[model samples]
Target chain A: MRQSRFGPKVAVAFSLALCWVLPIAAQVETEEWRFRPQLGLWFGPVTPVPGTHLTRILETSLGGGLFFRMNIPSNNLRFETGASYSYYTSPTIARLHSIPVYGALSYILPIHLPLTFQAKGGFGSNFLRNYPEGSRNWLPLGYLGFEASFPAGKVVNIGLRIDYYFVYEQHLRPPPNNPNYRLYNGHFLNFGLMVNFNLNR
Target chain B: MVKLRNILSFGALAVLGCTNELPLSDLLNNTMTLKLLGTYESNDPYGWLNLPVDDVITTSGVASSDPAIGGGSDLVNYVLNASTGLSVRPNDLKFYIDIAEIRIARGQGKAPGQPIPEYWSQFAISRQLLCSDYATAEPGRILQNCADQNGSSKLHEFFNGGFTYPAVDIEHGNYNHLGIYFRRFVTAPAVGFLGNGTFINATAPERTMVATFDNRSVYGMDVASLLQNNYGEAAAEPRMFPLQRKDLKLFVEAGHEPYVLEVRVFVKNNMMVHILQPAGGNAAVTYVAPIDWNTNHAYRDLFNGERQGGSLLMTARTYQPAKSGAIQFSAPATAGEYFGVTEAATMLTTPNMVLPLAATRGTNTRITNLPPGNYNVYRLCDKTRCSNASTPGGCDQAAGQDGYPETVAFCGQYTVSSGTTTNVPLALCSSACP
Candidate 1:
């Protein structure tokens, strides 16, 4: 069998979602979804592909983002939109600044206790800026991830979030004229702490 | 649930198939810098010497009386394999080559996700300009245009002999060999100052060194050989297509930029000397004396008369024009700290060869290539230090040179000749001279 590039990643995403939801299926159906507005902050490592120019020149530094989430009327369903910032610096002092804005459908797996879990999938555009060179472009990006949160108070929730992101970058310029340019399809994995405040509380 | 699983599987398979269309390396950070370094065998002084007509000869004091002298040679036989004179660096040096391609061979093991071994492959920085592109180009004309130290030339600078390429993509693997294909003709300016400060401004009759590759290496050729072989069609292609080196054992890893492709060319003992006789014929002499550029300001002063068949034959004195003379001086006095002691001593003059009037002590200072003329000398005496100059004596004598009178400032005048070096006497005295 020909191995798919995203075979392992899709399997992991599905398995995690199944593990968190299968046991709590009864809880998700018992109660109707209520409108809840949440503001969140997240920070974690931005890991590029292991053997890419990004990984070679840049560091696995922390990335941070702000997100807004609202539960829809559909049971265990929420619409999440967020903006993130990540930075990597090279040995030559060149820097890469990545900013991504995305919207995703998150499934809330409600359980009997205060603990809750969510599975998220999204597609967005990543704005990449290479410093010193001052070149910037927007690349197509997709990510699959899961988040686990616990209520801190009536208005605050804190937890950990991890995501596997894939970006497609293309170069159509012919060579000899532009010898240094090449195409890059980057893969990144991010994991960090997430703090969310319930705006509707 | 079934529909979601089917969609995820379809998306994963689609992405996998899409990625296989593009050629991708398993390793990243494979960018390597390639450098072409031209080095010399020894730091020996080398330059050119003219004959018959006494012209300006540029040398960095290459020849010395003793064969064992450091950075010099009594004689460096071109025919003798063991005799290699010092090959000094050439000032304003530039080399031009036409590179056809550069390729590398991979190891026997198969690359990741590949069925067969990734064998010999071409890099992204390959297939540069070819030699046949310059078939109609002339070295003499090209050198005249490109040899300027601070000038730009597309034909000379950008025709692909550039010494360094900073970003060459090499895949991750082990390499066994590297093949470089370039032209046979290597062009460079023949005129430059040698290590011993001998300047060879040979621009009129000959100006460039157009050398050909005799063997696999291009090291043994000197200025004489380059001059002799300076002819031939410029753009002619040779029989050999490429030059190669084997057993590189080069390993390129992913996420590393350590690989460097370096090519070194040796240039040593490159100067030549041609003896010119007044009687219209040349004679061989054993062991030529070391010519001093500083001492012998005049070229004609090197030899009194012609020597024929190993016998002294004095010819009539040929009247040569006056040559430029020079002035030699002892070292200057060190500047003493005078910050708080005296405000008037702020502009203290440190003596050097160029400023001969400001005399020094200990080391010898010489000013060469000065036109023959007459010059005057004067001095200024301060409380702490005295200066020998060509102006009226000024005094700040609260503490410096207290007893010295104004009359002592007139250190007498000296003349510079075409054949001799003027040794000006400069001294600091507290008392007036009788």
Candidate 2:
């Protein structure tokens, strides 16, 4: 039988709605909803597209991100989102800065222990700034990472994360008739320390 | 659990390795400098010889052998006043320098005589009047006025201060040679005296003859035949000094150390010569008098009619009937009568180089951020001239034609090292075509 393009989306949305409704119904009977507000320090190295003038102008430097999340009962999954900033040092003029907004789905491991592991996958839109004025680009990005967390107390969890980012292919417009212009696909790696507050507890 | 621990250890190592604390390559330390020392000598020992003025001739009154006929007094001293002829001096004169490839002298995978590829490899520098003081004046007026107002000086002193190339990154190695070329317009004065009864005055309409000293033209036949067989002389050639020095070695370093390479070049000015006069019987005396603003001080004695000395004697002066008996300074019947009267040969003396030119005193240029290495230095004639066998109707034999030949006159070898200053001294030939 043939299926409509929206059919899968509708089913996935219905399942997500049922999962949230069931968790809410159970929370009403059990007496609480689960939410985690996280604060983190993110840092890593970022490389620009190679074989372009931008590579010569920009170099790998440290950058960071901060995030917040809300837990769902079904499969121990959570909705996660964050804002991040990265920097690239320049030798000629000014430094380059990249700020991105990220959204992701995260799942905690089912291991029965005081310490837990989590995995996340997300998409982001990055806005690069502070380059040669009037030369800026918006990069569509993807993220994947792993985190290990341990409960410090009933209300807080301390975690460490290693995130890898992939920026989609893009091109920088060069002056007319210049043969040096090239397409860029950037890769960045970040490490962070997170402090999560269990608001529902 | 053990596998997870191993993965974490590898990840940690990779993160540490990707950190940005690694050092960047240190290419900023390479540099080379070519400085002008303003000290040079002439290859010819007996340099420029002064020719006599046009008016001094052998008549029944003043014989050629007379001590007072063509001696030191024959050189007329005119103070180049406002009304002097406009054509008595060259309009513009400049120096051109060229450097061949700089390469590693001795190293693995390094070849000799191969120059480093650089966009700034070939460039030119000129000596021109940049100040506004003489902006509106003619070249002759400017030169005369500057010399008169600023005391005796060289042309470069009143014009260009010095030349400095922008910073360049060169490879580290032993260099083969650096090439240098020079060109200028020399003005030879043909002055004489006109006389009315009992009154003698410097003549009008003094001829300022212009000559070019181009090394390429000196060896044009040699270079042209190399390019093509049966090639004719070029129709038009640039006014350039006919001297070149080539194949100088310079060494460059690969560190941030500073180096200063000074190139001392000597120019021969055709303005230094001696004039003789008969003091008494059978003995002619010459004085060591250089032109008003020249730096050469070498002197020559003209006696017994040797080296065309007989034609350089002065015969006429402001008529003083009581002291000197001359009714009038008669004009010469033929131009050849005054063989060496008006022309003077100028040379760069050893003493002048030791004492710097007064006008260009205390001028130095500092160039930073150049790659250090060995370079070959050369000097040659860089001018534009037409070929003799150029296609008819396709090429014109004008003075500034394209596809002109270049000639090398002087070539030598020197070395440049990092963190150390290298001085290269060179001498110009006294004769224009030597």
Candidate 3:
């Protein structure tokens, strides 16, 4: 009598999208959409939180990633699609090397003067390699980020990005009675310099 | 407005990420802890060594080698002559205990067929458990409930814990005999010292000889009397280590009531390796001797021809080794560890020259090709003892170290005759390093 997990997850996602649309539609601007290809780099530290097998033994590790993004700017709204390569390491066990390909939406804050702040959120699947016991799982990934950037030049902008990523991982056929082998969520946070190259320039 | 939306979105993701429960870490607490102590005694049935001849050394520092006229030339005779010391405890012993059943008898039965009352029944303790209820499962009951995860291979990591589940609260009445049924697989990192540091001119001051026991027949013993006993862990096959009354005690914690029955068992010299010589080979020509004992169990060396190298230190620069007398010995294979040897020289003309010698199993590693002089072999080790404090290798005696720290024992020393091959056979012993 096992039920499918797909239906409930889809229902919850649709509800979240509806909540987002009402407020976003009120501030929609009629500016023409402009497309730009960009390249970015980020580095930060990651830690396993409570409810993980490695929670007690795993040490904090510094991680880094690089991404190529396509940005379609329309007034206050910006649509982005990107593919990234992230790498992380632990002292005892585990090497988390993943490739996350995602589509995201960003909203520019209506603040005065020099610096511009953008709120970004995305959902995608992350393919991980070198997992514990050689487990290769493509985990569902979601991230929320905040970026503050100032124009470095007409062609490029140098800014700092803080992104928190969550990945859902499934157990690899463990003994059914032991709850210790259940599904867990892998978490990561990145805070580093992000330099974007505006392809239009 | 943007900051509020960002906070709400991040909070929702955080909730989704942290919804699962933490896995239990105390799964090992359910298994019983069986501590193995080594008791060395003459005429012990579990004894692996043939005999211990500690008092029969000649004044010349060589073991008296009487030629085999009729029933004499054997591994025990050859290897015993080269042994420095014997002990019950080895440097390391790791084995898997796949227990099937444990039964205790309340009465002393004269004949093997005499039936004794079961102790568990008298205490009203439940002996049967469901496989799904693994949280309270005893180590012996694992095979009864769950499928063997290692599958045919009984080699699995021993779960380390203090809590012995199926806690025995019953009193020790007339229960004098305890029988345990289990599957057999034991791995001992065999280490021994060869020469005494006494005679530097003829033999090494101390020489360490190291080997490993990947030999299944050498370490695997028949645990049960049942047919097809070697194949799997079944109730029909049972190996029993009868515990004496003195070894059984009633242990009660200081503030606790109801005395608990504690059974202490001693595993004898299971690591003792008997070195035997083949019957047809010429005593003088055949330098490589076959190592085994005549017993019910067959001994087969797995890692033959494995090359082992050790460092040799000469004690004195007096007698230089002549390019004539060769030291022929066999070094068994040890995987995943280091081997080292140091020797003191009483007759070396060169001052403190540390030479490297390699020994291979079933073959000869010639050291006679080196410069001629009297050389004293000092020490040999499976793991090198580093002199530098900063280097993170070798077993350290520092408090709270990772593993058990051990000292390298000095093997025996003997005078060497020129133009002859000296066979320094290695023996596995209970005591070492003194």
Candidate 4:
């Protein structure tokens, strides 16, 4: 597949976001009841299913996505939903992209410092872009993630997040008579940094 | 709080470092493998020989006129004066086998011995050079030989390996017969020289000719010229041959593992000869042999006799002791009226005129994943014409010229079992020529 021009650009943007937001986050105070909208970048390895002629040689790639979260009144849980896109690069010229739209319930851990750790779970639909024609277009997507966020300022914060995604489609399985018949699924991991805006603070 | 932080840390590490492995069972379960075995021969019926490269010289290197004729005439003598050094070697031949049709017979509303309707028309298989002499040779040499046999020094493989059909639907009734078709691979013509020449420049040069079995004057007519002018490109165009067999029986059962069909092809040597002697001692009479010594076989007779509607007869005054019984004679030394009778004769048993008795044999195995049941098989010569109404020219206009309205080559019934391999054997031999 042709090398995606989006990868390096995303990396440079993420690095710039981190450099600009970290020092400001260290000088900020904690905010409550704020809509924490996040712009993030992710880089990770992607392993394609064996025998998938389309993405047989894709092993790793870099991706990025934007997400938003809202803190519920008097609760440690945050409601989160976001959209993300990933690209798989391989020498077989198999161009593949994964786009997921998700909603999640994130629980904030009790901690003393300004940094907060959160665990999340979500469910959504992942639309595979640039896949081979006639294959399943969309798969049910499920995800689990963990993130650590620190206040950059009264309005801005810098955070790191790790998200694991699972996409599955019954139509992708082999025929019943074939010995290898099983559920067709993809497992992906995205880990990167996010810049958040405390909109209500 | 410390314990909860440790737990969260461990959970994050586990999710980020999860390992995913693909299932291997899907890769190996659906495909079947096939193996081929046997030997092949060229079986040139006309015994066309090959000339060594060293003996041949271009016409530009030789003088235009013959010194023996004394340069009195403008006719440049193109002579084929071969003496000894003649070798007979058949050129290697290779061809493809196309399994055009495969179906199982369903016994629905028909008698037990009746032919069944063809319900499956989705099977199409083609394997190249299944009958070759260099089946196990290197790829470079095999490709060169397949393209141009003249440049390769190694003997080509006539019978090679088998091929595999990864998937097939044999879920219905038993499949009993298979229809086999053979296609010729286009290659350069095999060429050879009859003899070396002694030009006035005191150099011996060789003349070249194609060693093809197609004799143009077989019916005392120039068929090649007629066909070329009338039919255009179809005169030398190659078409696939549908091989016919007498006894073929194969049975397949639904839900069986896989089945292997073994096919063996054989080509026989069918050369016949008849000699006619003189009626009286040295009378001034010319005799012509009957052309119908063999009903449909005349490849060799036309080659040795009158070539291109011209007589090869010669008149001689005196015969040299060494060349007394030779078929070809030199021009007489004295230019007076020679009263000897003109005789046209050829060594009927020369290697160039008679093909050596030989056979090419090969075995091919076809693997299919089909359900087991009792079924019958039949061979169709022309798939397009197999069902056409029989006319004066037979099905699809395939009769009349080449004897159409042909019967089924092989038909037999057998049963197939699921998960196990069934073997169906087919043997093909040449029909008698005379």
Give the interface RMSD values of the models in order.
11.7, 15.8, 15.9, 11.5
Give the better candidate number (3 or 4) by DockQ.
4
How many clashing residue pairs are found in candidate 4? 39
Q: What C-alpha lDDT values do all the predictions have?
A: 0.42, 0.35, 0.35, 0.34
**Largest TM-score belongs to which candidate?**
1
DockQ of 1: 0.03
Off by over 4 Å in 2: A1-20, A23-32, A41-58, A90-94, A130-134, A169-176, B1-434
Chain A vs native chain A, TM-score per candidate: 0.76, 0.70, 0.70, 0.68
Report how closely model 3 matches the true complex, as a DockQ value. 0.01
Candidate 3 residue B305 Cα shift, in angstroms, is: 24
Q: What is the lDDT of residue B61 in candidate 1?
A: 22
* Residue A107 local lDDT, model 2: 85
Give model 4's TM-score versus the native structure: 0.32
Question: In candidate 1, what are the lDDT values of residues B1-434, reduced to their tens digit?
Answer: 99999998765544333222222221232345564422210011112212111112213222321112122222122111132322232222333344555556644433567632134454523333312122212432333212332223332322222245333355455666665555432433222222222223323212322244322222111222111111121223221233444534455544322334544222111111222222222221211111111111111112322111101000000011235455564443222101100012122132210112122111224444334556544332322222212111221222223111112233445676777887755452113322
Docking class of 1: incorrect
Top candidate by lDDT? 1
- Per-residue lDDT value at A140 in model 4: 63
User: What are the per-residue Cα lDDT tens digits for candidate 2 across B299-411?
Assistant: 11123211221111011001111111100111211111110100012222211212111111111111111223332222222132332222322223323211111223221
Worst 10 residues of 4 chain B by lDDT: B308-317
Worst 10 residues of 1 chain B by lDDT: B310-319
